[model samples]
Target: MLNSVYNKKQKPSTAGETTQSNKSWWKEGILYQIYLQSFKDTDGDGFGDLNGVVEKLDYLKSIGITMVWITPFLESPMVDNGYDVSDYKAIHPRYGTMEDFDRMIYGLHEREIKFVLDMVVNHSSDQHKWFKGASSSRDNEYYDYYHWWPAEKGEPPYRHSLFDPEGGWDYVEAVDAYYLHTFTGNQPDLNWENPKVRQEVYDIMKFWAEKGVDGFRMDAFQFVSKDTTWPEFPEGHEKDYVKWYGLRPELHGYLNEMYNKIIGKYNVFAVAEGTGSTFEDAHNLVDSDRNELQMAYHFDAVNLSQTPKGYSLLDFKGVFSKWDNAFSEKGWLAIYLSNHDNARLVSRFGNDSDDFRTVSTQLLNTFLMSMRGTPYLYYGDEIGMTNIDMPNIEEYTDIEAQGKYQSALKAGADMEEFINTLNYNSRENGRTPMQWDASENAGFTTGDPWRRVNPNYTEINVAKQKTDPNSVLSHFKRMTEVRKKNPVLVYGDYTLLLPEHEQVYAFARELDEDKILVLLNFSESESEIELVELQGLTSEKVVIDNYEGTAVEGTCITLRPYQAILFSLG
Candidate 1:
């Protein structure tokens, strides 16, 4: 019915009659996200560098990745691990020199692997030249580059800071004014309302486009546009923050200008870090006719399992299904489970215990690759990396975790409970060094690593899984190959099955004469999934399965614990 709901809307041409050709490279290719600092380290200075990524091109190709999204390697204060950019056009010495960056870029292009740079324009590190000038005097040329309110205004209306407990406004004695920072105090929010500031951001994007970068992942862009009047937000408004701060009507205007000035000219696509608060808001940002962005990367699913109680299977299914149905007609979506800002996929959404880690990781990957949108797979997920077991706040290196810890301490919250939740939900859990082998520092670095490697690396490293036929890495390779070979999986009509099933998530993707049914068991108990809606159709072949063999009689099949199976239907 959700698919039919979109039938009345204008429809675009499908992928193909038998194989895909109509879709652009971005829509057809698989995207792999590499958190630059955690990926690999060629230099022994404890930081991962550009040459480290250059060395892994062949490995990325082996996993069937066609596109790579690298987090900020641009010059930064590293206050937020490269998100607090001080210089957008220059490479950070911690990452490597400009020459090394060019080599990395050339290596990717030579392998036909598209590169997507992380664009963090919402804010700039206070150490930036523009911020320095802006804080110098009221008459400074760059004073308009950032948001500032004179201290004489009594107290500016309240705004929440994600990192600062004091609030979003920080008093700068140099100019006797307060500047806005939506994140850490060291990172000041840019004034997009100013023409000069907007031009600066556009120039930054163009600089990358000139470097042959294929695309950009705009970080925290949903909150870029502000009301500027700095009206008082009602108490408790921070609970539903995006509704108040995101998708201002003026944002579309800026996006339209950016597309005409840079994105369209460079033939590059842009995906926002998040959509606005509603389905309508999401559509307005990314619909093709809107000419703003190419895809919406929403957070509804990623935020679901952030609590100690975990998430329900039905709620998990609903979030994804709702997103898919919302984008069925016009706009597009970026599908993912885990990323640099969240805990590992297996730890958050699947069973991470040794008994089921491999199967559960494979099952989750099957869901991601089988979905309708372009899937974005995080690095280290291929080998089933789980969360780090950190008991004390001192073990954490992420600013987010440290901020939360201090906030809880100041609020008189229970430290033990907070630490327990932090262990399960901290973003640092996902930022640990990649487990390349069982060697010292997991083969990520020979010298001291910036962060401690996960202790289980000896058992779950890539070298251990690389040669195993049934390893998580192998299943990932097979699933990607299957998706690459089947157009139906990429651009198909998704129809949910077993909508009320507690443990089994089932769906069918059909394009023309080709139809594939996917079944995933989300629990440790065996699940009997009877495809009642698909009674008349029979499976022509077992397309892929996590388990060695799949047993199906008619339209019913028994799914083993954490099993994933795909069947080509006749």
Candidate 2:
């Protein structure tokens, strides 16, 4: 619990929306990602469903989240969670009926919250009807729906999967052929080269848009296009499948076509999840003039340069700085440190200890809200949710986690060391149940939860934070309100002030006469920052600081542990 007293009177409205850009609502509003199955469960089935999400629209609204991205709940075989879609248009039975989804969309509209459904176009569930037919025989009409290699060859090309040791090629004994699966064997990759396949995807998109969904968050969309030839890597770069197989020239044309067919026609928010994207890909996919996508998220900051000890902030600076300069003119980037595929932010980057948890979480929020992009907040991130270390590997339900655990044991890795890695890097860290209150199951459900709730729910639940102004949730609400009110924060020129600084992340955002300086202490100990460069500016005010009554005295301020302050300078 936050012991420091906070002033709620200084907070603005509880909605993070603005008319900052005439471009669209998607650009002007903040986005929050919710893994719906772990969000809430109303059916007492221990699983979160569409009905449960409909029940929590007000909670999202309370947190000032204007746009919500719900992860896939579409019909699936429950292999890779819901990512292995069996039906693109229908809701899963465990989730709820399609009518329930319609009601949830309507509920979101009632709150003026934009709804974005997860669109997984990279692949489909191996049990999907089309795949079923494709694997049945090459003579079937759906034979070309998936990527299948010749059975006569005995073995398909060796395609590597970062997720599994068997790689991306999975043999189908029924067809005596190999089908590509970038993920698990249960999820086979689709053949985007097929025009009919593309058309089928478009029709699915049309189904949701016609039903009044606000947007689509395409999952691993960059992998949709790849060279059809499975060429063996000329040695030494075999694991470079992600880079060589992605960002093909054909992808831009496919995106442009999709943009024109659905996104442009509906004027809907569209962002691709390009995990291995580069700045050049960013420019090609999202530059406004290209008419491809509104924006796309890359994994440079989240996956690359990370180690067991921890991630390097210096490398983080390099990644963000690269994208900032790349998208400074025409394109837009997404500002997020963690998502469904990664661990919790506080657990990954900030100190989650009791002494510094609150301030560190606030500091992370400050960076997220003040940055020049659509800030994406994970469901529980708003309340500073930390990672949970499950007692055993069996308790982890995420497919990737299970795969890694089994693979590690096979490799003779130390059990304790492997568990430590899972503790720090598992995707299941983000899929834990949302802590709504201090009650049983964190008030997410009366029945058993699909996943174990973080035991810290007693101190970190929303019920406790809603009324406490100093709570992490309260700080997020205030920061969101600030971003909504300040247009410069959304549309402004950004400059890195202390790129080489070890413990402090300092930057400035300026738009004409309106300028603001952001200073973030990224460590858990106090430090004195002497802003000699800021001395040139005499007239400035400390507009937003997590600490109460923080002052900017004579260009030198003693920043408390994890303190974040914004000074308005003209």
- Report lDDT (CA) for all predictions: 0.87, 0.80
Candidate 2 lDDT over 1-570, as tens digits, reads: 111121112122111122233345676679999888899998898888888888887887888878889888999988888999999988899999988877887777777787788999899998889999998888889989888887797666677665676678877777788888878888888999999999999999988877777678888888888668777666646456557777788888888888778776774768888835466767777776677777768777787524358866777777877777777777677899878898888888888899888889999988988988888889888899998877478788777877777777777989898887787888888889999999999998889888889999999889999999898999999898889888788888899987888888888999878888889998878878888645644334766788876654667877888999888776
Worst 10-residue lDDT window, candidate 2: 1-10
Model 1, C-alpha of 1: deviation from truth (Å): 35
The prediction achieving the highest TM-score against the true structure is 1
Query: What is the C-alpha RMSD, rounded to one decimal, of candidate 1?
Result: 5.6
The digit string of per-residue lDDT tens for model 1 on 144-168 reads 8999989888989999888887789
On a 0 to 1 TM-score scale, where does candidate 2 land against the true structure?
A: 0.93
TM-score of each: 0.95, 0.93
Q: Which residue pairs in candidate 1 have backbone atoms (N, alpha carbon, C) closer than 3 angstroms, thus clashing?
A: none
